[model samples]
Target: MNRILIVDDEAEIRESLEEILSEEGYAVSSTSSGTEAIVLLRDAPYDLLLLDIWLPDRDGLDVLADLASLETDDKPEVIIISGHATIETAVKATKLGAFDFLEKPLSLERTLIVVKNALEARRLRSENLEFKRQLTLETTITGESVPAKALRQQIKLMAPTNGRVLIYGESGTGKELIARAIHSESPRHDRVFIELNCAAIPEDFIESELFGYRNSAITGGPAEKRGTFERANGGTLFLDEVGDMSLKTQAKVLRALDEQSFVPVGAAHPISVDVRVIAATNKNLEEEIAKGNFREDLFYRLNVIPFFVPPLRDRKEDIPSLAREFLRIFGREYGRPRVEIAEDALDLLKQYPWPGNVRELKNILERVLILNPHVHRIERKHLPRLVYRTTGRRSDDFSTLQQAREAYERDYILRKIDECHGNISRAAESLGLERSHLYRKMKTLGISIRESVS
Candidate 1:
């Protein structure tokens, strides 16, 4: 049940509110003194708080002032009520994060409605805070190498600035993760963080996707749509694989970046925005520009704050920590205790040249843990041939034919799953296996059927 606290000096008013709220299935508490209300708030959690402006011992606004000092999760939605409330008082309460305000003689109907809406909004805020907390924990940079330290420092320094950032890195080098880190650490952390992949969308639809369309803008345009820029106003817009953007679209994007305004597909009026653009590219944009595939003006516009994400192979010494971090995460997710990596297995990971970079390492570790759920320790005997190749050693790392066969089967199934975009049925069909049988095979092979599907 939603909990509500009422603070009013009038005994009758307090009794009336407490009765009504209790009848409405709320855990209602009322106190006539502002000092006593503060004591109650500090003792327990409340979904909503109702404070009257006039109090004998202390002013009601004092309670709102104390709210800012409390932890974010402990703060309640405050509704200021006053019989002679002025416009200035209402504005002040709003500036202090009041959910809503009501006049002296409260309408029971309006009070209930506001309470319901305020509780719902509070619930949403709590969920969002939890998600952001988890996101911050997961995306934490987890390496101790020099490159890692340097990169973290650069992000810290540049994240607060409004300069456009261009991230250069190889595929699977955690470019998107780094972009999100920059956004989360920036001043606009509370605003939207929009991402678009130039390589994912077709050239014909890319323009409309970035800068939305009006009714009948194209063959199948929606009546009205908010483009990425408008949605990400006062926030961040991350453009991934920007090297793949078409020359025509590049020119349009350049204009938007320069002017912070763009016209929709079927609209003549240009809409202005206040988004910070962050572009990422795996290919060498300078080389692409020389080849006439990428625009030079666009390159300069995006390169205001350039960042190069080092590949996994370049930071081999950081492998043990990164590997263990992944193991801990995957273990918790798979409902298993932390999986241990033998020194040999750790050495192989460090020596291997991760062509796909950190993303590949994460994927391989996830597969390993999901498959070896019952195994407490990962050894060379458990390492896949894909990892063995990185050791500059022969295939003799595995002592048994069964291990080799299992490794081969695991790799083949993973590739098929990728080819089918995580569709188990489609992968089974392509491999000439029954869907049910393939699921059994995956389970037996330690390839988590659940993790693969996503």
Candidate 2:
């Protein structure tokens, strides 16, 4: 429930407001002195404060000034109430962060409307704060490799500018995260950050999605809808997989970038927007341009500042940190907070070439957490067979013959078990060994029967 505090010298007025507000389903508290109201605010949080200008202990405006100095997340929205009506006092109250001003003869309907609006405004402020916090957490770059450090430095240098950025990376290398980091550090950080995946949308509807339609522009669509360009006005617009955009859409997008204005479908007038464009693509745009698939002009417009994000294989040294970060993330998500990875398991992770990059590693960790709910510390045996089986290591990669022999045996045994669909007796029979001997070999190789089967 929304909490309201009333600070007025008049006992009759305070009691009446408290009763009315309480009946309206609000938790209301009344105090006859501004001093006591301040004390009450310090002790607890209130959504709205109804303060009277005429106070017995202190001036209500002075109390509002004091509120400015109070450092609290749950600061109340002030609604200044006064018997003496003056334009100057209302302006002063507004300048001092008062949400609204009310006269001596408060209308029940007006008071209720103002109170509701104040509470709603406070709720929106809280939500916006929470959203920014989450965005910061999600966009953090979690690696200590040379490439990772260079990318961070580049973002810091380029984010403050209005130049267009084009990110080049393999799929799942975190191009979108880099875009968001740039937007968060940019001058327009307070504004909206809109994203549209060019490849994900159908070619037939890409134009309409980029520049929204008006008055049933499509057959059965809404009457009027704003596009990403319009929604991202005075902010940043990220176009992911820009290489996949058709030549026809490319022409219109180029014009929009040049003119900073575009007419929505079925609309007569053009809407101008101040938006910084950031584009990302996995395919080589230069190759696409040469192949006559992508437009050269659009590529030039978005490639003002180019960023290359290396794939996970190139940054193998960061695998341990990345693995632990993923573990922490999925652990908290799955309510398994103290989960830890063994060093040997991390070594195996670093050996494998991540085909799906960071995204694949994250999925594997989450899967491990979900499948092994009782396990606190993740060991090599807890990992899936694919992780150790398909490492694709050459004999020279191993320092000793024993290491090479053990790796070969581990792969061969896993293949047999997999071929038998994880049947231990059948696998042992095919290998010309007893079930107990096979189990002993698996234990030596750090392979779990349950993991292989599951």
Candidate 3:
């Protein structure tokens, strides 16, 4: 059953919310004071909370601060209610971790809709957590290299503790794979592993998206929404690309890490959550700090369990194993009996500096499988142009110094044409060549002017 708790000093307000929520088929609880409300919340689990900002004994925000200090997983999704709270208070409550805030004259339709959405959000989270638990039993770390072995051992030791984890690696270096490995090995493996890509979310909405929003409607909708942090209760929250988060949002995050609770955007009551945070980033966070873009305190909090993913260049010995794994997967995908790697091709692969890392390797293998037709072995000739180097040059010779300069000019003109923004005239001006000359040079270079410009 969906459970809700209403905390307000006014008896009528509490009764109204309880009656409406209960009629909507929620198991509802109400309290007339923040003090008693906290006590009640501590005793039982609630899916959502309706918190009033003012109380006779203590301020609702103070109650939120206290709730944030608690060490438990049953913290409620809090919505703050206030008669005439300032914008500053609302923002502060949100920064502190309130789900959202509601003004005095609350609408019944708005309240019911928000309540339903919050309940549904919680339900989806529960389902996702169950899925993660199943994934944990099925997945395993694949490589047998020294770095992989050491990483697995470190995860085994660190998973049981509550320390935050910072995972650093380049793109496709499998930072998230390692994070999931740690979570699966941890005490909270059975709980949800919620992820937020800080770089993917727009800077304007990062805070509300992370902490959540209170009474405010979902963008382009009439109903309110719950954030990822609330959804990850009793689990691990993974912040991928965390270095991309804006400085403003980073400060709020630092506070949440310090206080262990926060209010969502446009909320009144503070929401408390108990979650182990794991953050991943491709960028150098130290450089980001030097640029004054990241919070120092938050850095310390997350760095308590730092793990670095070794780039493929640093562990070239693992290339053969990784290559075989990719080949097997691609062979099954293509379903062409079976495919094998030639000794020469494998040697070429080992020698290549893979700047794009594992992703690049996977793509190369897939391309080779597709283009090789019925060939059993992938050879070097089937590789992309970027992977190969020719031994000799000087096939086309210039007659004189002026002719060589003209040839260089022709190549430069063709390149400019290719780089232009789909405008022939613009390419002509950019190359300091007449449109007619540019067109003629393009023809001689065997390049279509329109194709090159585009």
| Each prediction's TM-score versus the true structure | 0.61, 0.71, 0.54
Write down the lDDT that model 1 would get. Answer: 0.85
List model 2 lDDT by residue over 4-69, tens digit each.
Answer: 999998888998899999999999989898898888998898889999998988989999998888
TM-score of 3: 0.54
Give the per-residue lDDT digits (tens) of candidate 3, residues 1-454: 8788888888888888888888889898888888987887777788888888888888888888888887874466778889999998898788767777677788899888777776776677767776765585334555677987788788889988888999998898778887888788888988999999999999888887898776775577645668888888889999999999888999998888788898888888888989889999998998999889887888898899899888866666667777777777778768864677777566546655677777788788887778667778766545553333211213233346664554455456645655675577888898787889877866553344433443
From the highest TM-score down, the ranking of the candidates is: 2, 1, 3
Ranking by lDDT: 2, 1, 3
**Best of the candidates, lDDT:** 2
- By TM-score, who's the top model here? 2
Q: Better model by lDDT, 1 or 2?
A: 2
Clashing pairs in 1: 83-104, 371-446
Summing lDDT over every window of 10 consecutive residues in candidate 3, give the lowest-scoring window: 388-397
Candidate 2 yields a Cα-based lDDT of 0.90
